[model samples]
Target: MTRRPSLAGRLSRALAACVALALIVMVVASTLVMRSWMLANMDSELHRLSQRAGERLDVEDAPDDEVDTDDDSNEESDDDSDDDSDDDGARTTLQSSGRAPRPGGPLVPGGPKGHGFGGAGIAEGTLQYVSEDGEAAGAVVSNFSVTYLNAPALAILAAVPADGGMHTVRLKGMGTFRVTARVVEGKTVLVGIPMDSIDDVVLMLVGVEIGLSLVVAIAAGFAGRAWVRRELRPLGVVRAAAADIASRDLADESGNLTRVGEETTAGPVEVADVAGALNSMIDAVEDGMERRARSEAKVRQFVADASHELRTPLASVQGYAQLARRDIGEASRTQALERISSEGARMASLVEEMLTLARLDGNRALTCDRVDVIPVILDALSDAHVVAPDHAWELGEAVDAPVLGDESALRQILTNLLANARVHTPAGTRVVVSVLRSRDEAVAASAAPRGPAKGGGSATGAQASSMITIRVADDGPGIPADIRDRVFDRFVRGDSSRTRDGRGSSGLGMSIVESLARAMGGSVRLVDSEKGTVIDVTLPAA
Candidate 1:
């Protein structure tokens, strides 16, 4: 199966693009700067060379009678002389002895100005001069007095100048150049220089730029992949941990995953937060598992206890009925009939208690009525006194202690607490029930007692005008600390062996009390009894 791209992949791609773009920009900028610097240096060198060549073309004296009208600052009569010849095969005027030196004389003194005798001076067959007026007698001379260039430089030189216009040219086998000139004193001096060096430098720089761009692209791609991997490592851990968890593993207390553990919280903030969420889910799952287990166990135990409680009476009734049917005397029939009636009555009582538990489990809507909490406690105590005359029962009342709930559930809760106190304690143990307004002792009993040994029999009770609390405690052994929190679970009595109670105590009493109190928006809890287990019942004030 094709997997979808992860965040890491996308992030790496984006980072790579950014890095590549930045590198490209830098390379282009550097290349342009290098090319410009190289070109400028070449141009400066060319200009310097041209200046030196122009210096060499100057003459020592001015020609007379052909005064350059453009500027006449130098005007002197020549005494006598004729040496150089013009293109017409005519002898041209040379510098005479008496002629004044012209202003702006020779750019440099003593420079060559001539045509070859019987042949024109052309450097290496490339540099040549042609006149504008026309060649005279197989000779070409420009109107400008002087011109010079290197024929070997022709291949690298620019295009030949047109009259007075500057032009650039690329020679046949050399690089490009610029050739230019302006007429000075009725003479034209052309200068040209090769640009091969500058062109070579530019080409080299272009190559470097392209190479750097490729290198940068490669480097960015590798860096992007590494960065993506580093950033995504945490998320990978989360995925693996999640996959390891399963439904069956939810109840394994030792292996269960929770957010509060060091492993989950030890990482980066994002990972820690994710771990915390997982821990919360784990906690909820564990609690649900515990509750479900208790519920199922209670259901099974209930079925067993009901069978045991009703079976004895049911069997008795069946036997008595059978005996009555087979008897011939009225006395035997009447005696069997009496035994049947007594068994039926016992079954009836057991049924009533079972029905009460069922009602509590169904979480039916409760009836709200103002009940004096003191009276409720006294009533429960009075019933306990009658049920087990062997145990001592004590009661306390709080002034104006009132509550709102189903009167019957409250009565049952108190009855169950007293009954638990009776069953868990030995005969003649003092069972104190106290009720008081704003009594701190009663409030302390809302928490679970430590245990049957260290935590039992130390239960206390307290009360507030706005909330009523009652405690039923004994002097016998209390609940164990380890299982104290679980005592309120359905069908979970302090004793487990069915043989301990030939008529086993149905463990749903505490469960019924807890469920009923919660349904009525109140709470029932165990407290540390002075010598035995103490239970505290709290309800909303009327």
Candidate 2:
């Protein structure tokens, strides 16, 4: 399998490719521009030389001075004289510029040969003179041993319209040249300059551009690699941190774990954002892990406690069953049978409560309906009074408190709270069951003395707008201060020794109340009381 490039590597390659492309484009464009300018200048120079050749031919073709007797002849002779004078003047101008007149023409003051206009190596110009009737007049070759009047080159030169504009032609024996033809004195004059110099310059420029482009591309690659690596250093730190975390067993109890610090999370905004997000995720994961561990521990303890609670009743039932099976007298057998039945019923009740808690833990949806909690509280109070008539169970001023909840779950919550109060309190303790239609604020105020209710309903701004609360308060010894916070925890009994009313209490009563209340979109919390425990159940008012 091929190894894919990393972020830094990809970034570096991309940057280097961009730089190389830009340099290539710039170099190509500049070379093209330079070549165009040089070629244009060369053409201009060729045109100038062609124009000079045309002018020189004009001077050479001028008629000579002479006289005639007839009127027509004299007219022609006079015209010839004027032409001769013009030729003399033009030749004198040329001579003044250090160029001698034609081969047989008169000489004028200037420098010697090989020094000025007639000098060798002065210009690589090949001149050809052609007559109007399509015949070559003469040719002049400079800076070379042989004349460039090859048939192919001559044909190309003769094809020009003598328009004084530059054109390009390739001489069979002379490579390429820029040539221009012009009509002068009944003949066409062609002037050309070899293209070797321009070609050489273009070649040299290409070589330089290619060399520079390679150097720049290589340099950019290295620099981009280094810069990209540095810029992405924070990403590497984040990656390492994640990998380190992944390598560790998060389930371990030890809280010592590596975390990315501000230094690594403080770079570029995007990288910083990623680092911050990673840190937050790790923190949340750690928190969740802790909560999960605590939940598991609680579950384990609950199972152990439940087993212990069931074991005693089971043992008693087993002992009584074995005793009943013996040949005892009728009276003794009947008592043993009764004890067996009682122990069996207790164990069944405990098992049922455990099942209920398991169902609640499974997040079973509760029945949603408009329930009048006032009636539920009254019924619970009546039952509690029946169960413990020694305790003064009084019902507070009843109110029509309608709420949305599961009717059975609501009744169960009330039953548990009232039972917990009656069983835990001393005889003659006034156990008050009340129903009140109030807002969250009023409930909070009344519950303030209790330092907030444990496992209480957390209402949204909208839900807290109104609520229905059921209070089960007793005037017996209130819950111990030490266990107040964990009153709703599973298997937590008011008596830490797990004994209540001279028997082992299941310790799941309060836990069941809180779970049922919450499942019904409500909450159960212990309220502060001066004498005895006050349990309040709050639900969203319908």
Q: What is candidate 2's lDDT per residue for 1-542, written digit by digit as tens?
A: 99987877788788879988998898889888988998899888777776666555432331122110112222223455665542221111222223344432222224233321223332544544454433343233444322324334445666776788877777555677777777777766666677778889888988898898888888888899998788788888899988988888888832655677898788988889999999888888888988898889988998898888888888888999999999999999999999888788778888999999999989899888999776776787788778888988788866785888898988778777777876677788998877776544533312122234444443343345577778877889899888888888777788765446444567888888877777776666676656778777777787
- Global fold similarity of model 1 (TM-score): 0.56
lDDT for each residue of candidate 1 in 301-383, tens digit (9 for 90 to 100): 77987887678778888998998889469999999898788677757756876787787678678898987777777778788
Q: Give RMSD (Å) of candidate 2 vs. truth.
A: 9.5
Write down the worst ten-residue block by lDDT for model 1: 131-140
RMSD of each: 11.2, 9.5
TM-scores for all predictions:
0.56, 0.81
Alpha-carbon runs more than 4 Å astray in model 1: 3-13, 35-203, 223-295, 328-371, 375-395, 417-433, 437-467, 472-507, 518-535, 540-542
The lDDT for every candidate, in the order shown, is 0.57, 0.68
